[model samples]
Target: MGYYQIDCFKIHLTILRILGVWPTENPSPCYIYLSGLFVFIFTVLYVVIYTMNFYFLPQQLEIFAEELIFYFTNVGALSKALAFIFLRDKVKKMLEMLESDMFQSDNPEEIKLIQKAKEKSSFYWKITAGLSVSANTVNVFLPFVVHVVFNVKLEFPVCRYSFIPEQYEAIFLYPAYLYQSIGITSHMLYNVNIDTFLLGVMFLAMAQLDILDRKLRKVTDVCVHTNAPSGSIDKMIDDENAVAEIIKCIKHYDAVSEYCKLIQEAFSEILFVLFSSGSCKICMCLFRFTMPAETKYFVFLTLYTVVMTLQVMVPCWFGSRLIEKSSQITFSVYDCDWTPRCRRFKSNLRLLVERANRPITIRGGKMFLLSLATFTAIMNSSYSFFTLLRHMQSR
Candidate 1:
């Protein structure tokens, strides 16, 4: 629980467990069954409701745009669940890495850096979760509130269906409403938790790299080593402590690299869904903004667009930071008192720098690098799509 010790991640894992995607270590058969069933419900809901709705709905851009806002929930939820199950081996390795001793730190500075990273990751997920909850709340309750206050007929969240006979329509409408609400809410959390977990992994890797950079500098830091041999400063690199510390730094950096590769493997397909579907979701969300609508829908769109943007932005952010942290490792090795160190130490450091020179890169579907530039590109594509849709709507 090295990283799970943080409360945010603790809560995140708990919610994930409830959603059935993360069954925990050596879960009971009952737990697995229940989890599987819970996940299945959303998959079924997506197949039954969204597809049916799409098939039956008119070919109007405005109607499709309105419906698209909710489309991400079920598909994303099911895809993430499948990703976890399909890549359970990778997920297991990730859990092992998260709990491994390499991530543990006794130094206050290193611990602080780790904590700060977790805190930032926590803020990102929490905001996303909160927005998702808020949006769903408005959608579910708006009908009841309007019905009671304004004597208006209660309407379902999205496309109303003929699931019940006309005579029983009034009786079954409320139940249908509750059912859809549950599906959407569960799906929303499912998507949010997976995202938070992935972003958390990236931030954690960056923190470990930063810690390694700090250690690399201190390994050759001669001024701090009072026991340096007299009259030969470069010989300080020959000290056993310096040798041991450098070896530790090497192992630590290697562990971080391994952790990153496994993470990229586990989430490659899921990230593809997130970025590709996420861009269209954002584009439609913005496009939804231009249409005339009720205040509640407008509010939901505002928050949904923010969540969509964050879904794309946060990954690119953590991805870029990960690249930067790894890239700067070489500088960290050279910026220290390494100029006075011996040749063997310099050679070992050079190997480490060479490895660092490649840097860690996490991509979406192995197609686009997850960096801010990529994020900007996705946003530009989205804006262009929005522009195209707006033109169609005007005609």
Candidate 2:
């Protein structure tokens, strides 16, 4: 027999036979009638119990939202912190490069500062890397605990079974619970993927920053010394004024700043896309519409909490990225050897210096984007709240 057929036979012949309901032939008309009646009664009981419980005891649903909000917020914070730590070395090296030209490019002090910054950023980056994987795992699993709690409430009654006088309530009660339980579990899984994606992107950012910083450092190290290309050395411009030297060496630093900003902007854009897509929208709609009034209110409250958290989070994140990008520019310029004959080179370097300054503008752009996103989120929240209120009033 096929597996499904064998499973059906086993359930009917063994379990149903033991209970004395196994059919030897087609069920009689009386048996079919009774079965239909029982199913109908069970359906009625299920609907009544589910509707009553949902409309009355919204606290149960509120508890689930509260747990989810807490878990997700903490995960976001920890992931961000760990990501910062993992990129620390790159940040330090970039900073050193920016300050490299503060003294004579050929000076040992300038090289030493660069070296120290690289070492510091590297150590922190390693430490943060170790923490990020663990934090991500925790973020993925934390919501399962809440899922289990909701599932239990769905399956088990808070009151005594005897208190429910209807036979249908006893028969169909758990299935209604199963539906919401499944929804809760699905949402938790979705949250896990979101956290994992964020962490994965952060890991990539850390790795790319390391590679970029290493390349820039090598180039800066070469520029730190006074040896010009021979044979055509006379063709090369040289100058002593720090500003002129700065203008000359700005190109390489500008490249570093641009590369870093490019990575950050790309990552942010991906995050926004991921959060606003189809599945998130559908899930959010169900979460709002399926719950009763008080539960819906609590959902709005949770949204408010997320808003406040994001307000703090977005600004801090933008500030850190801005400062880091600016530091990379500073270190790149600092690595240049500003000498008396480098005047023409300095003029060519002006373009690069200007490029290095571009990240500050990019940083400002991010702040503007974040402000727009925040406004959108607020508008959505207000619309949802008012619509829900109108729904209640009409009812």
Q: Pick the TM-score winner.
A: 1
Q: Residue 90 of candidate 2: its Cα lDDT?
A: 45
lDDT tens digits by residue: candidate 1, 1-395: 33442444777778877877777779999998887887776656554677677766667667878777667655666788788777878977876776788788888999898888889889878887887778678777777789889989887775556345579988887888777777777777877788888888787888888889888877765345555564565445355455566777888888888888898899988888877888889888888888788997788678768867887888898788889989999888876666655566677788788888898888777987889999999999899999998898889
Model 2 off-target regions past 4 Å?
A: 1-173, 199-203, 206-220, 223-319, 340-348, 360-395
Candidate 1 Cα lDDT to native:
0.78
Model 1 spans with C-alpha error above 4 angstroms: 1-8, 145-151, 162-168, 222-240, 289-292, 390-395
Instruction: Please give the RMSD of candidate 2 to the true structure.
Output: 18.4
lDDT (0 to 1) per candidate: 0.78, 0.39
lDDT of 2 by residue, 209-244 (tens): 333344334433334324556434332432333344
Alpha carbon deviation, residue 281, candidate 2 (Å): 15
TM-score of each predicted structure versus truth? 0.88, 0.37
